[model samples]
Target chain A: MNAMTMIELGIAIIILIGTIVGFLSAIGFLRLPDVYNRAHALSKSATLGVLCVLVGTFLVFLFVEGYFSIKLFLGIFFVFLTSPVSSHVICRAAYRSHVSLAEISVRDDLKEAIIENNKETEDM
Target chain B: MAIQVLANLLIGLLWVFFQDDWSVLTFFSGYLFGLLVIFILRRFLPTKFYLFNLHAMIKLLFLFIVEIVVSSFVVIGIIIRPKMNIKPGIFSMETTLKGDIEVTLLALLITLTPGSVVVEISQDNKIFYIHTMDIPDLSNSVLQSKDRFENAIKKVTR
Candidate 1:
């Protein structure tokens, strides 16, 4: 009914949604078939989950605490920028290390490219 | 760059005056606010360098948000279901965009999108090796990724 209560309600909803998303990401990690799929689950769901939580925290600080912190904004930005890069690096390393794809995978386009590169190097 | 820094300083001072707070946090917030203002007016400014188009950036951001939410649900569905019949595969996509920044941005976008992760980039940077969780039709998947993610990034960076 009051402004403070309303703000509290909004923050609770946001945090609840974020918690659900984080739970789903963990489920995805357990249920997905392969490393690539697991990575997808971790990167997309986990990143969004954290972002939601951070945004909710930002709102809380801005509305309830009556002060803004640049640290929160920077935390959100750094997570947004770095998560994808780290995921990409992990996937790339996995691929290069020849981690087998899922059994149902239909294609291996990178295999052909790598083979072609090997042939070119051999020719040289 | 010097002018931009001076303008940001002025904005920061103004923010301190209005907020009645002289903390480092408020100063950085004001500087960020100034950068945002300049970003919005980038196109109209007389600068030699190609300023990022705010509209394109915002559009890309919106697209990213939508994609993230949609894909998160999709992945969650795949996970929660009793039967998981994912046909994952690595596909090579040829891109028109050049430069490390543009290509890297595209790869990052693809990796962030649900059901896909970029595994490799060719030596020439023309092709991206992406691993997708579902690839019922490889060509269609490649085309869809090109249209959905790559094109949006191209609009922003190119």
Candidate 2:
């Protein structure tokens, strides 16, 4: 009973931490200036937040119920795999649609690449 | 190619769960069972089974987890600060990686690892346009980190 309680406590702490991280990521989304900045907060940090929560849930199912939740494991796996792709496509589409970076931001090497790409394609 | 391996792993994992034990014996037996299943279904699969190097894949996964944790803290610190002093920009990086699976994995690793997310890939997939949140020598930092990830990925795919 004592060991189970301890395990439950640990799981609760993990879930709590994940909620905090997710909250922070949301705040970051609202505070950031543009698409790129928002993507940074949403992609990696949010993924981490979800990961912690999913892991906590998985642990709970394993230890408390004495049952393995393959669905939860698959959830963790697919989220980790797709989060980056989702963020990558969003940012790519925004950039391709001529979304300008915020005034406070500096550096844009992609512009040159786009120019060169267009030139190469036109020549073909 | 990677799908077959993932399917096998899923089958193996399912076996462990079905048996309700987390022992190595259970997993290996499950893996053998999955192999038989795959053998019977080989005619239906688009890709053939290949030798999967577990050590390299584990190393890559470990590297990814470590990088994600470290970078998560870094970004969290930046977010919680009073002032958001960030110089976000998109930068192009050239890569030596080839093939669809390798390039895709590398891109995913880059997005997950550092302060960089892949904004775009060139038509030929030889170049990547990366967007990063800071400007205090982050491009080089990203390149160095990406090189580590690339080496790890090559061990698995190539």
* Residue lDDT tens for model 2, B1-158: 67776787899999999999998779989988988887788889775444445688899888878888777777788888899888888878889999998999889888886678899988899989888888666677888887788899888876
Model 1 chain B: worst 10 consecutive residues (lDDT sum)? B45-54
Model 1 over residues B15-84: C-alpha lDDT tens digits? 8889999888888898788778877777776652233455777888887678777767777777778888
Model 1 reproduced share of reference interface contacts: 0.83
- Model 2 pairs whose backbones collide: none
The reply for model 1, stretches above 4 Å from the true place, is: B1-52, B137-142, B148-151
